[model samples]
Target: METDMTKGKPMEIIIRFAIPMFIGNLFQQFYNVVDTIIVGRFVGKEALAAVGSSFAIMTFVTSILIGLSMGASALFSQFFGAKQYEELKKAISTSFIFIFIVSLVLTTITSLFMHQIIHGFQMPMETREYAADYLRFIFAGLIFTGVYNAFSFLLRAVGDSKSPLYFLILSAIINIVLDLVFTVMLNMEVTGVALATFIAQGISAVSCAVYTIKRMNFIKFKRKVILFDKKMFKTVASYSILTAVQQSASSFGMMMVQGLVNTFGATVMAAFATASKIDSFANIPMQDFGNAFSTYVAQNKGAGNIERIREGMRGVSKIIVAFSLGISILVFIFAPQLILIFVKKEAVDVIAVSVYYLRIVCVTYTLLGFLQMFYGFYRGLGEVNVSIILTFVSQVTRVLLAYGLAMTPLGFAGICLAIPIGWFLSDALGVIMYKKIMVEDSV
Candidate 1:
């Protein structure tokens, strides 16, 4: 069901939308948690480390897909709220065709150069072959991932978050079932989980498309409307291109960090991997909430509800403060227990390093959450270049700090510290840009 977010109380609508999205994203993230646990315990640390390395590389490719989908989402939400039926329908098809082509091209390129791409990151020898094999299988489903995400974001843009949750739940179930069968039962290792994820992507993509065609008549395209509209193409391209570059740069920066972590040996690599996933899992709720907040702003922007958007931002700030502080405390306290879940009891060094990363970094979730909220705020306002600038500045700082400090005595701890610093810097810049935008709008 399409929701008219422009009509509801700002926080109320956002929370309602975010609840389902948070759950869906949580389950989607569970795919990785399950893979890490299964591969880490059943396979070995080497396989766990390899999966981690491969994850960074895979994320870089998928980030482009996500960036484009986010762009389409802003456009979709805007057009829907404004009641521009024709423009909305045209954009739906335009963005879909554009994303499909990009996905296909990426899949082809990544598949052909999978080995070279993985090696380019300078992964450790112990895990290079493992990473390559995992990536080779995982890249097989790029198109499905691209298609699923494009539609999922589209569905959410128009306030249909519940449907994606349902489809993703089904997909997550398939992935988990296959994870056990291939990794545990058949002993396929990291490759098994990769294939499982790939199959699940296919299922989700197929299910989302089938559901959209049958149920989402609002976004359904007619033959005439399917052709590209010059205005619509320009609008979407303005949003997608820079956002795609920023998103990919952010991942590339992480890949750079992974390369740095890899130099410290597989213990650090595995620890970094374990800590990264746990951190990401802990933070997914606020992140999803940020996305939900963006949709609310976008819809209101379309409706020209400036006061409502302001109301939403203020409400979210309170939530960010309360939620970030609460999550940080929990992650900090449970850091050791969380690491233990992924590592054997005897791997003392891995446990220590992973726990160290978690505690130090978890303290910065307040800044991180605010940064995400700002990113969503600007994205909703159609000021994507602000987002690009904030992201690039932060990522560049992270990469530079990761290398510079890693050379000093801090080592892996230096890499751990780089993250929060980056978030804090980005959030500062976000505050500045937001104030400037508000001032200009007043003028």
Candidate 2:
């Protein structure tokens, strides 16, 4: 399944490549969606708010781990595309070793400060204990989370997207079954949901590691040949740290927005939580396309196929526009029904707030889609610093606007407006940067 994207028609190649990733991302969303639905329905709005509140914190950690893995994947794709097998092998071993060490350190730090972090967010006093308990177990399982992401991303880099998709499907199914048993049957509440995730992710991580070792030739980590190379480590780190910062920066901004919403009490928090999960789902096509396009770009860039990269970019934009428009229409029209999926009919305040938030954000999915694709293109070209700058600008705009607008007459609605405003600003800058790069390449 290792595809040579440099040879085919760019549009055909990208669409073919992107489809597997898009499906995989949908399955991947089961991690959050299952937990939200079960917890919201069985455990009540307070429990839902608890899990939702912890999302920003967990996202902050997941982003760093995922960013590092993405950096390593891009490196692998570049080398693989260039047909540099020896160096690629060494890079793989080094990246896995480095990420392992970082994961442990991050887990320890996050676990130790769990209380302070939740308190700092000014979470509702009633839900603080539930949120704290959920986060502790999640932090305990950070290794499984980090390892699975690393393995999955490495596989995708080699064009074996199907393998990871299969594994993710298996893991998601396991998680959902466990969610039903723990939250509904046994009434374990937040604790049960967290434990279910930990077990499912652990299984997936072990399965992926075993498969990777047996199947991937370039990924086998023989100690003698795998000794750290200063140059290679720096190359990987340089790419990873920026992306890590970018992801964490965006998560941090969302954390700020979460804090603003928390001020309005548990009803608004529950509303934001439900809308955010739905929002995450709505953005899947955008994210998956960006991911697919990034891998495509990296491989083509490695092969020095500039024109093909541009071709793929154009092809991806059409898909983005179509998916964006289509999803926006559905979500906009069915916002209340979508909210009802997580909340009960009696929870009128939660439903109303969630619907209002979704309507405001879903309409702007097109802009967000554009932003993600451009970010992927930049990252694929190994212009990660540009990607980081774009994230910073977007996050900063969101934080400043969210805080500034939250106090105004618009209140919570202002906070929602800030989401797309950030997207528009970032997309504008991203488009400018992308065109500049293409123009320079032409010259």
lDDT of 1 by residue, 221-316 (tens): 667777767778899998877678878988889989988888888888999999989877877777877888888888899999888887898989
Model 1 residue pairs with clashes: none
lDDT string for model 2 (1-443, tens) is 67777787877877777778778778777887788888888887888998998888888888889888987888888988899888888778778888888899999999999999989998988999899868888898889878987888888888777888777888899999998898888989988888888888888889988887777864455658766677788988877777788778888899889988899999999999999989988888898788888889999888988888888888999999999999999999999998888888999989999999999899999999998898788888899988888888888999999999999999998999999999999999998888888886641
lDDT of 2 at 16: 79
TM-score of candidate 1 on Cα atoms, chains taken together: 0.98
Off-target runs (Cα >4 Å) in candidate 2 are 218-223, 441-443
- Whole-model lDDT values for every prediction: 0.86, 0.86
Worst 10 residues of 2 by lDDT: 217-226
TM-score of 2: 0.97
The alpha-carbon deviation from the true structure for residue 10 of candidate 1, after best TM-score superposition, in angstroms, is 1.2
Clashes of each: 0, 0
* TM-score, one value per model: 0.98, 0.97
